[model samples]
Target: MTTKTEKVEASTKIRPRIGRWEVDDHNEVALLGTRCAACGEVAFPEHQICVNCGSESTEVVRIKGPATLRNYTIVHQLPPGYERPWVVGYGEFDGQLSVLAPIVAASRDELHEGLSLSLCVGVTKVDDDGEEMYSYQFTPTKA
Candidate 1:
């Protein structure tokens, strides 16, 4: 005899804070970026024009994780509606484009330049409407 498996559907469908990042049908999160057809340079937030060569031939592309931590710092003072004392840093992806995002680490000792980081999405803050705002962050790679 075999046991039957049951499928549970999500009660509520979640959406991203910004449409740039989205969870695909496979439940995989991907950051949307723009690539210049002329110079082959990529830009985040899906640029309409290429910032490098000023080319209008920009195409939207999916940028996947495994970025390197170039630099980071702990922010003591935070803006309104933000959780204070958060770590912010820049992660270099595709060996060219560096994206600034929150860094999630257990301790500062686990953070350093050239450290491997994987992109992840999580709730950054709650809006006045009580909606959960999501943002991308870089977490330490697991060995």
Candidate 2:
């Protein structure tokens, strides 16, 4: 019989596409950021030094809540190795942290400025080693 830990490990074989995010045992995705201890400023992707006060006192923090879509655009021309077009947008969380990521939607008409977005993890690409890679993206929250 398989153990619980083994089952979880086997099910979570997909690796993160980047170092800025992580997937938990429940498959929940959270973006890592840095919060300045001195100035209370938050920066995405985490930072070693605070951009506001130039202090090295910073701690890693998880970004939460639905982000507000500030702006977006559809890209028709993609770089080599990419087959389909995609939508990218700038979203702000808590009115403080802003992140630029791919927007997953059924159609371009579904997207609009000031729309609420939730963070989620999805398969992005397969590495040369044939392993699936996952990345964080923003999806429109259900009405």
Per-candidate TM-score against the hidden true structure: 0.79, 0.76
Clashes of 1: 0
Clash counts per candidate, in order, are: 0, 0
Q: What residue pairs clash in candidate 1, if any at all?
A: none
In model 2, state the lDDT of residue 19.
Answer: 37
Q: Per-residue lDDT tens digits of candidate 1, residues 35-102?
A: 99999998987778898999999998888778899999899887666677789899998687899888
Candidate 2 global TM-score: 0.76
Model 2 alpha-carbon miss at residue 87, Å: 0.5
lDDT of 2 by residue, 32-121 (tens): 888999999998877899977989999998887589999998877875433268788898998787898888863778788888998876
Poorly placed runs, candidate 2 (over 4 Å):
1-19, 24-27, 125-132
